[model samples]
Target: MYLTSKVVIEKEKIKKPRGLQNTLHDDYVKCKEECRKIEEREITEKYIQYLKTELEAAELVVAQESAALQATSIVSSNNQNENKLDQVPSEDSILKSEKETFVQEENLIV
Candidate 1:
């Protein structure tokens, strides 16, 4: 009904139907442009986008969006923390990795 064709009473009246059809047709056509411009308020792109955003915020995965935002902030904060520290791997971590690698090599050679 939204994008459907407008009333074509004028065109129908061309054939000149009688009785109720004729009377209703004349009645409808009498209005100022016959309600063709009934919906005068233009639907703006901004309003439509706002409506869509509101609908998504209300009905869609709001929690998922919040979780994603929190995860992103946490990741960014972690990166910032790492940058602030500006340090290489600690001795224990490096030693642990080296030991793991050596164990793997020994297993391969055996």
Candidate 2:
């Protein structure tokens, strides 16, 4: 009878620690899962913020390029107009040349 009681007490002691270990393991797993979820959320938010920044930068570059193209176009158009004006002669020069040629022809005939 004494040996049987001692064995029973030992079994109870062993069972108690096993139960406590199972509970601790379950709690550890829950904590790890929560940490993983938080990390994933943080990483996703950072990526979203990065993408927004990149989009804004791209838009700015595009706007700058568009403005440069427009300025170049205006400058080129002005230069072309200036060139055309440079090639054209004034009206007074044509009349002076014609009068000189007519007088020369009259002197030749005389």
Candidate 3:
């Protein structure tokens, strides 16, 4: 009877350590899962920041191109106006030609 009680006491001690080890394993898994969640959140935030920077750069490029296009259009319009001005005769030259035509007509009538 004495030897049997000693064996049972040893078995109880072994079982206690096994239960503690199982609880420790569970805690370790939980910590690893939390760490993974934090890492994923950080990566998502970095991606969002990268996208925002790209968008701002695209907007700036678009604005610069629009301004350049407007400047080109204005320059083209001004050049067209200058070309039209060059083709038209001055007022003084027009009056001189008209007076010459009138004198010729009077001579022909005489």
Candidate 4:
């Protein structure tokens, strides 16, 4: 009876790998590889996001410099305009002053 039981147990163990469960191990390995690929993809996406953020920050810095340059140009133009206005004389006052000088010189000569 003990020998018969041992034979039966070995026969049952032999039947464990029939059709359906044979590929289960292969499928598990494939699934593990797929999970690893997914992890790599997520890491690449995060790196792309970091680069995009850095690009946006660099663009903002360029915009700020452009604005500063524009402001400086405007201030310089305004100063030049003010200086030009100070140097320019009214037309009527210049003619009247010239006429008085001519009359005074003529009277002195006479």
Clashing pairs in 1: none
Regions more than 4 Å wrong, model 2: 1-21, 88-110
Give the lDDT of residue 52 in candidate 1: 93
Candidate rank order under lDDT: 3, 2, 4, 1
Q: Per the 3 Å backbone cut-off, how many clashing residue pairs does candidate 1 have? A: 0
Mind giving the per-residue lDDT tens digits that candidate 1 earns over 1-110?
53333446545546644545567676777675545555443346567888999998876687888889999999999999988789787999899999999999999999
User: Per-residue lDDT for 1-110 in model 2, tens only?
Assistant: 99999999998777555537788787988899999999999999999999999999999999999999999999999999999889856678789989899999999999
Give me candidate 1's TM-score against the actual structure: 0.27
Please give, for residues 1-110, the per-residue lDDT of candidate 3 as tens digits. 99999999988777555537788787988899999999999999999999999999999999999999999999999999999988878899899999999999999999
Instruction: Estimate the TM-score for candidate 4.
Output: 0.54
Query: What local lDDT score does residue 50 receive in model 1, on the 0 to 100 scale?
Result: 89
TM-score result, candidate 3: 0.63
| Model 1 residue 74 distance off true place after TM-score fit, in angstroms | 7.1
* Cα TM-score of candidate 2: 0.62
Q: Which ten residues in a row have the lowest lDDT in candidate 3?
A: 12-21
Candidate 3 versus truth, CA RMSD in Å, comes to 6.3
